[model samples]
Target chain A: MQESATTIAIAPDQPAPRLLEKAVVGAGARVGELAEADALIWTGKPRDFPSTLPASVRWAQLPAAGIEDFFDAGVFTAHPAVQFTSAAGAFSHSVAEHALMLLLAGVRYLPEQLRATSWQQREFFPHVGSLRGKTVTIVGAGGIGRALIPMLTPLGAHVIAVNRSGRPVSGDNIPAGVETVPTDQLARVWSHTDHVVVAAPATAQTRHLIGADELSRLKPSSWVINVARGSLIDTDALVDALTGNSIGGAGLDVTDPEPLPDGHPLWTLPNAIITPHDSNPPQLRLAAFADHVGANVARFVAGEPLEAIIDTARGY
Target chain B: MQESATTIAIAPDQPAPRLLEKAVVGAGARVGELAEADALIWTGKPRDFPSTLPASVRWAQLPAAGIEDFFDAGVFTAHPAVQFTSAAGAFSHSVAEHALMLLLAGVRYLPEQLRATSWQQREFFPHVGSLRGKTVTIVGAGGIGRALIPMLTPLGAHVIAVNRSGRPVSGDNIPAGVETVPTDQLARVWSHTDHVVVAAPATAQTRHLIGADELSRLKPSSWVINVARGSLIDTDALVDALTGNSIGGAGLDVTDPEPLPDGHPLWTLPNAIITPHDSNPPQLRLAAFADHVGANVARFVAGEPLEAIIDTARGY
Candidate 1:
């Protein structure tokens, strides 16, 4: 509306999503045409990205966290002058929420209670556990893990955020009491923490991080929740521990042989809660991306550093 | 031990429970016999309470939150000089945690997911909801409601705490953003909030607070969680809402005609989650009570006003 107002264009939708339009405008930026806009908020696939962009467009916001396809599509090379930001951390809140739900469900013994047809008060009493005063070792201090720490701490669960460097995960939202542990020192964590939540990226180094030996060291009441990639945990070992009731339970959104096959033991295991990797479903992504756009747009309008900026050289 | 150190006595158990003794000692008090004690920590029934207390005894801590049985036993009348404290807020954490578990479970569509034997990611995607940017109206900002507010806020929920007076609910643990509404104003909340947690006490005026009318106002995605006494909701209306898919679901730790009759339709409802009021089970009580004892002991030793002190005249 003003000469100095920053203009952001929304692509792929003839009329962009109302939420995204509101976010852009709410953050003190105006939605406008791509040719005249200062930045573009993209929701379409990398393949469909514009072959040419006007020089006025200085920034582009991608809809997905991982922009590997964008890298392969050479979207970065053609627009060398433009700054690009991915929706990396925007989607983590929902996944972090899912992790908390799984941990709470497993720790409090919800799967068993869900199956009960009658009131089993006396019988179920001993099994219902609380996280208060218990240590929850989250393997990986990434977006999801960081988001989860605050959620768990309020429920009285002590958080041990496992990162590669063991650097303390300090943030405005994260309480000061969280412990930081290095991935190399994970073996020491098993004997200490009451539960484990695997949220690490799956790499050759991270694969099978929680095997039988690690599982054996954990207490019988300990629960293991995996919201990251499935390969981070040894699924066979997990099934064995679950079958023997050696560990309390496993709440997994991701699985090793994903889709998990129809007759997998994890399906029937009383303690295992499988949610089919629907933690950050399609419907929720637009809102999260809109939030990312709003914050970045606010930054862009103010001529400040933007979030989740892509490293063109490194191909992230 | 210092000569001026506080002396608290644990009755009934020969060695007095180790945890309670540890709590007393941890809180800078020395656990001693009733004859030499300045305060008595009673874990026994109202009938088993010592008929008489030493003149040195100036305070008494009852194990349960509700001290009505102790009142019925005429314990307060006999020990007119002793200050009394009930284990009220201490045990609310577990129940609050349980309420959260139920809410998160219901909101995220866990009941249906737990029943799935195969991968149904596409089918489950739309049902998976997040608390982010959602309104959660907690009825009755008591200990449990207050405890829950802090937990929900970290997950990006805007909390509206409903109390009888609508006095703003602020505590060390509770963040500053919570909106408080009085009981009479609760009718206006159902239409706006995405979820409702019924934590209000069951009083003559509060009974059936959430009937068919209230349920009808909530959206199809709204979940109703009741951790308080079941009478606060009309079970038939709740059934209709849950059965007709008029509401998202009901996650109830307490049900009317509780111990919720074995063959009740609630037990079999796909959308209904029943935990048989076992949120605060017997097994978890000792630890919670010990925590209460520790806090009270610390307060008593510091010459500070003790928590949850019951007035003999009012009989809480």
Candidate 2:
């Protein structure tokens, strides 16, 4: 049988439909109308998925890496025929770099150091630290975690990665010399680590994963860095830990009740360095998403196994 | 010939005289009185060098890497017999990491990001950027510059290192693939670079090395990170550049007229991040200095060439 041209559509609800259309066309896929679209590039929120998804569509490409929202929305239970793929690893590079940035900032106390109006050299000296000879625990051995390993290793940090399973993750992204452990072992790893970077996907099981118990396990000199969803950490516990000087510091790119309200204690905390949930650089977001779409479209056209296919049961 | 016992005195004015004394004794050197010492560790300010020097001392170790003060004091011109070694590379790891921290903070608009009390995600998206694929120009291809190259290279930055000779420095400290360029060509390189990290020593020739003329050559989006000495960049020009948005931003750990006075314009500028010259962690400083002293004392006992020996003529 002769190969047929794949019919895809730039969803009307996408953040930038024109950009999606350009990417689809650039990838050699025809932009079909709603009734004819075999696949869709979904750019809308998970809550809006049910209303926007067409019965004709066989595949749906989600812009977000996290899919816990979809599971909560019951998309999997409703649509058995459609194959869903999330942009899981598309923004890994950007996000991993941000995590490193946050870690570096926390270790060096950049926030407090930058706040000084006077020469506070003597006061700041004891707080400053180098990443060298430090132990870093990455809680979530996925794309972002893998990307962070190489960057951290080059700085002489011993990286310990945590995944759902203790098994080794196979990928070019996984730098050599990293110790992979299961999530349950996170407690055992805390006391030895000087830094903890949260990159786990948000789920009921993982929510508040770094709560009071986990915070208490960490050394007084340890810093907590979260580039993943803020829900992964317990904000109340974090605030307490930071305020009470339980932990060295925290670099949070995401926060619970995000767009953290005005007069939040985190805003005033000297140890807290918040970046408004923007780990993925806005300048690189669309381009990276486009690249993912372009590659996946080619795979779909070739009748090959797709990348980032969401396991309906796993919801990652 | 058997190595003679070397008597060394830990300077009274040193930050941690007890630690220095312990290290010297630990390295097989006896702690002697200043008048009877064969070698001494001088930890006083550069201006106090002439008054503090003892004629009987044959070898003196300066705690700071930059020795511009000795040149102005005419100590080198007067005493040609005594061998002087500065703790040049001992603190490189700490300082380089701090420089990287400053660069990352500036690129992410950390100063602005931390200022937000609400989510303001959309407002921050456009300002966000990553160090990946950025051109970083590191002034002074010495220990800190060399250390920074490897760290930046892993993040995919094209590193251009500037030195007095513009020749590739030979040492394990120097990372591969970095382009070593002469200081004279800085004007030509600025437009292409996204960031400039000043790690040059403070000297008459280097004072105000990055003034208006140099700042103007850079792209308006470029960030300037200084971890070396405040004198390298003209502070007045820096404040003007940041305030006018002539450049992207400035991350200064060191500033002129040290302890930048309260109410300084640079303090209020949203684009400036000042850290009060505390790049070297105080915890690491004494230990690193002691290691350097121990190694140099060993070399002195063996009558071998010392490490970090200063060429007073060069005024570094």
Candidate 3:
């Protein structure tokens, strides 16, 4: 094991520096100025990361679950010596709940009926669907996927989890009854599933992983739910499918080129339920990140392996 | 016990007489003409029930969970000699799932976001809530309520169920971990609850049960979700509260004067999600009712007691 970190700095801070500092102190680490620290807990946006870190710093912690920001900002390549960890599992429960909300919203046409100027019961009745006796394929069987499995199983959904390497889920928090498969088998699983939930991290290999070809394999009554990242699906293909009524619907929390332009067709699509990527909103994110920092800081101080360590090459 | 019904009839039947006939026959009861039927499955709208029934008809099975329709139409009072059973628990799963959808939609401002013309994540962020660490009081701890408790408990909610008699749930399907309370105690449960789901059958005692007084007792942040009957909540009081932002929001599947006329204030309310009371849409209702009829027919033919037997005076 590596030696314990003697000092750490909270960097480019805006929201919860004091809360994070308290957490660091609670974890038996002394807070020091950025230049003098052996480790840094980064709380600012990835674009705000300093061009260089002092030689004293051995590791840095990121505040967000998706580390694509750092990769896009060239932070990892720029600082080859720094080991980085992300607040991945910290907010999974809340996000997973939101994803379930989106999936159910799509099933019941909550979005369409909510916007109706007149009573639409008869019109919407035929389209109303249920999660019961349905099969849902969850891409990226990590923390969020694990949290969602328990909720889905009780509702009678057969959960097919697609992980990068299809490692067996081994945590006490993880529920049984989920069938895990590697990403390679995702193509084979689509036809049998009633719903598809994208929860995988945004990586080059996963980008546009579910495009026209994959969507074609799904039933016309199937719903595609994206809670991970927008880039995972090809937006154009999604728009075509929704417009053509080829697929049942989509429940998207994230979109490519997000903050999807004002007049975007997706905003008006009846089958598409878009939430502007607010799955894990600000207040919840702050508390969850703080929790992650506190635990990771304790681990760092104890010379223990950290949670959510990122693979720089994968860019998750 | 009533003698076994050798023959049955699927009556008035707008939705699925053929399906019910098949179910009845599948249960070993022959489908005969109405006048010759010893048992009748009333599959049409309650208003359509014949004013007089043949003396041969010993039992009449209702195709709906809400038996208030029969009582309101004077069918039960007119035929006091006929035993009646409701298709209650059969469709509870679908309705319970819809209730969960509404609760989550109310928390996440799904309706508001769905209507937004532009990306509104930041605007909607502060209002987004989660079921986690929430206390949800479920009014009407019957079939739908029981099914919902298991889903809510797994999501970290403390479920307080309110029933007519507040009897401890005893069915095998009734999941444990819910605290059952009488409807009379609803006043005390509001302030502590983050959300309230109304699933009670609409009866004389339940009309306007959640009015200005009950709404006033709740925290302003609390959400009121009605998936049962519109009358359970006073629409006028709800409008006033929603207009004044007195409560957090509402996810309403049923409404007073349902098929709420165009230009109703609710149609434009930002916080209120009105869904035309389509929670248990046609397709699911048919299959569920068929299942109930099949099971009850088998029980009746075997000289066993029926399920969901309705008390004429109580009107549930």
Ranking the candidates on lDDT from highest down gives: 1, 3, 2
- Every model's TM-score: 0.97, 0.74, 0.75
Looking at candidate 2, what TM-score does chain B attain?
A: 0.75
Q: Write the per-residue lDDT of candidate 2 for residues B193-304, one digit (tens) a residue.
A: 8899999878898999999988888877789999888889999898888888989999888888677888888887889888878887677887789878988887887788
lDDT of 2 by residue, A4-120 (tens): 667897665634456577778777788787677889887777777755456778888988888889888987767788998999888898888898999998888877777767777
Better of 1 and 2 by lDDT: 1
Best by TM-score: 1
Q: What DockQ does candidate 1 have relative to the true complex?
A: 0.90
Whole-structure CA lDDT of model 2: 0.83
| lDDT winner between candidates 1 and 3 | 1
What DockQ, between 0 and 1, does each candidate earn? 0.90, 0.55, 0.55
Q: Tell me which residue pairs clash in candidate 2.
A: A259-B119
TM-score of 3: 0.75
Q: Tell me how far the alpha carbon of residue B312 in candidate 1 is from the true structure, in angstroms, after superposition.
A: 3.2
Task: State the lDDT of candidate 1 residue by residue for A51-84, as single tens digits.
Answer: 8999999999999889999999999998899899
Chain A TM-score of each candidate structure, as shown: 0.96, 0.76, 0.73
Candidate 1 vs candidate 2, DockQ winner: 1
